[model samples]
Target: MSKERSSRILHGFISACLVAAVAAFIILAIPDHLGRAGIGAGSATKKNFPSAKNLSSIVDLEKEKQAAEVKIENPSGQLAYFKPEQVPIPPGQDAQAQDLTLTDPNQSPDVAGGSGAAVDDSSFGNAVPIEPEPTETFQGVPDNFVPVAEDTPRGSSITLVTYPRSSLAIHEPPAHVLRRSKKEYSWIFTPPELEKDVAFWKAIYSRYDKNQVVLHHPIYLDIIYDVVDLGYIEGDMRLSELEKQHKKEKLIEEKRERIVSILEMLAQNQRLSSSLNDEEWRIKKLFDNVGDPKKFQRAAEEFGVRAQIGQRDKFIAGLKYSGRYLGEIERIYEESGMPRELSRLIFVESMFNLKAKSSVGASGIWQFMPQTGKLYLRMNKIVDERNDPIAATHASIKLLRHNYNELGTWPLAINAYNAGRGRLKQAVQTLGTKDIAKIVKNFKHRAYGFASRNFFPEYLAALEVAENPEKYFGPISYDDPLRFEMVRTAYHISLPSVAGVSGIPLEELLELNPGFSSKVISGDQLIPIAYPIKVPEGKGSIFIAAAARAPKSQRGSIRHVVAPNETVNSIAWMYGIDPTRIRQANANIRRNPSKGEIIVIPFD
Candidate 1:
């Protein structure tokens, strides 16, 4: 057979098989199509299938392809052939709900909000809803503040009270109140005013940096009062002495002038003709220009002027105490709404010395004046709470709060603390601005000394020195903080009595209780009733119990025998007692008690 004819016969046989397969596939697809259309039970028709006429109709293959592409792009719209019974339920979430019987909706109880599956509550109970735990909100503390403990008494919420800068004058604290309130009130300094203050006081603080002056003495500039140096003169000579010195210097000058005139006359007459060498002429000129020794003899002594910086090693040693209180002081400052940076002011105020005192009568680590101390602290005959580190810190923070509220800026408020808010207000008012630069330049008062102008700058310097002590100062170490626990007494008691009860030495007890006045230590006064006394840490309960059992006779009493010079005030001063109390105690006796009269000193 020819190869072409055999190939033609094979192609015809293959065409017949393809036709038979296409017919079989169409016949099988009809049942599936009918079942999907919900017509499976009794429906079967050749008309339902694609007919020859439908296949002959013109169809755009490209359009069909585009439709397919659209369907593929929107997969969510694609039909899913899933049976309701086939879905897998989460295990344990209705474990017994295996049978999903379909029934009339009206016949079942509404299960929308109900427990589950319309089950009988008597057999399968409802799941109890869990109540969410409550959340507590803390105010005034920084987000990053890590409270030491959950139960510590320290973390009560503090609300921040803000005052507008313009309203400062309206809230101006009285001059006397500002003066004696808190010494650090005067010690407070903010950043903006600090720039100008640094410029003004940099020369003084630089003395410490330069090693020429290890001590920096800053006097308040009294910018707030428009009084330079607060009417304080470190040293001033009597007018008479100054006049006498002037006369003596004048006489010496006349004598020198007369000699010079005579010499000139001699030279003009050629009578003073000489062949004097350069050395001889220089000596002669020196004698002519020399002032009288007696006239200048008392110059240095006149004002008692002397460099304040001394004992560089000792100053650094004093700062060692600062390390012990740093953590505690900074914490209090933060809690009190004070900028923690100002805690370094303690280095300037007392060098962290809890027993520190100023010549002008500021006392304690915070250097509060007695008058100011009395306002915030117990500064009576028995107790001077200003000396207590913890008590003084709280007072100082309150003072800072006042300053910030009134002055509206930490810098201005801090200056108000040191220089007096009334004075600062005046400076702000007179300058018509709160700008530190303008106030520094335009504000002038005899009372405003270098200290007031440079307080914040000095504080900044101290902060700088403290922050990097190793860089500025040499190697340094600090004492361990004097850890203590406080206990309150129900009745008046002597510190010595407390010392006796605690089995601690009297000196150590006194050291721990710096708040107690000297009279209390001397047994002339008693610890204030219901006052808190500090004991070594973990010993408050022991001390309280022991103190309660202390002898009543040794607790406290005052008795004085009138001396030759013992007036009520004089007697009061001797024992650190109030004169009124002395007078009241001796009401039957004359105001001027006779010598040898015995008087009872009352404690109220």
Candidate 2:
């Protein structure tokens, strides 16, 4: 066979296939063409399927495509077929549904089927559901948002939070309270205007990348009143005590913020001596640093910061104590090859009264609180080394050493000792400079806490008076460092019991056991077995031996609780009694009880 002849034969076959496909489709869809024009060929009547020629002439494909689908369920029955065409979209709606779709609704008699089947009477158990459009009039939005044309996509449902951006600022209030009373008329007062303006003002301030003033539009003066807080003045702030100093501090803060505000207002109003950016930068830097920029500006404009804080003997005393401690500390000063007199800091802190307790619960000559003392010193039911000068001094030294290791500066270390290290570090970081005065004025940061703010100045002042005590106090007596003998008990014991046995005063015994409390020392717990036992200079060994026995009168051993800053020997001698007798009475009196308590005092 020739190749050209074979190619022609293939083309003829393709043409024949296309023509047959068209004819077959027309023959199948004849019934659907008849039904939509108010006629049905594939109706219940059997004759509807044959010769449905009138339906084929009026068919419109585009209109049929635009119509929505319809579902028709048929129960078990004889096969039926129907054909319809040109189904239009329903009135006031885009489309309608048809029950069924068939490739050929009206077909030749050999094919038995109905294109759009009707639901049977027995098949009524199943139902189809249709959804309706939602109803909500969303106000404040562009109104022409409905879907009108066919095939248009639906838009998203509107919601409250998803509303426009410009509506954010006034959407809700921070807080509100409502009250109803039978005794009075209904009344409503809005929140004071002050906080709103301040927050808004801060928002304005935040707009600048490295400067301020982006937009400026003021409401009434009343709105400005909302931003200002004069209540901080306390209205009737007292001028006595430290009140004057406090008022000055508060005023300084106000003036500082005002300075920033003024510079911003001036630059924005075009009333400045330099570029707006320059003024802004200066104001912001001043805001970030210590001292009131406003005050500094005023001072620069007027005179200068020439005021002095007048000399105070108390301040001198504190500095002197600091110097004294610098010369005599045990672990940090002596052991670390540092100055020994540094031990005098403890004296400045608690006036060398081992039993002194501060308002904050700080105790001992070192003024270590209960928890802090517990950490470094052995403090138990029978022993608290914080009262003992040698023991507490060692603990203080160790504590200072730890602080120094963490913070290189001795001044900062001292600050950390009084104020916790965390607060000191926070203040240092906030001020960008480790200036003590700056830390004092930071009301927001914990660095401004009463104790922490005062700690540095108080410590420095302690050093001053310690150097020359006689200058402040007339010829202050020199009390020698106390001494004691090491006495070991074979069993559990109380000071009063020991006093009764030895005919020694309980107060005397208590003075020796300065580190103990509860008078009852258990045999098991860690306690000074050979604790420093003080006795009269001429007392014999027989007296000490006799006091070692436990007795009832001595069981509830008592010691004169020497008031703060009182001397143990002085109290003992005051009662015309031996000091050893008191020590024996209260075996557990750790540190001398400065606030005098009943003690086993000997007769004169």
Best by TM-score: 1
Expressed as tens digits, the lDDT of each residue in 1-604 for candidate 2 is 6898999999999999999999987766665565555466545422322221121122232353234223222331112222122222211223322222122111111111111111111100101111111221111211211111121111100000001111001221211112324223111111132233333422322212211112221221112211222233445455553784476556545654555465446434444446556645554344343354454344234322221112233333333333322223332344454433355466447655545778977776788777677555544344455665545666677787787677666656777888777767776776776544445445245344545554554444443344444444444333322222233222223455445444466577556456655434332222212222444332323222332223321212122333443344434323223356556655765435534344443221
- lDDT, candidate 2, at 362: 77
> What lDDT score belongs to each candidate, Candidate 1 first?
0.47, 0.39
Give a tens-digit lDDT track for model 1, residues 1-604: 5999999999999999999999988878777688776666655422343221111122232443233211111121211111122222222334334222111111111111112221111111111112211222111222222212122121111111111111111232422244444454444334454554453333333323222321111221111111112011213344465665455445444544443443344334443326555533432343233254421222222311123332234346556765555555555565455656666667667766777888898998888876666446554455566787666777777777787788877777766767888888888988888876566556888666555765666666665555545554656666665455444443345566656544556776777777777777887555533344555544443344434444431223345556553455544433334566667767776756776777765533
lDDT, residue 339, candidate 1 = 58
What does candidate 2 score on TM?
Answer: 0.37
Q: In candidate 1, what residue range of length 10 has the lowest lDDT sum? A: 101-110
C-alpha TM-scores of all predictions: 0.45, 0.37
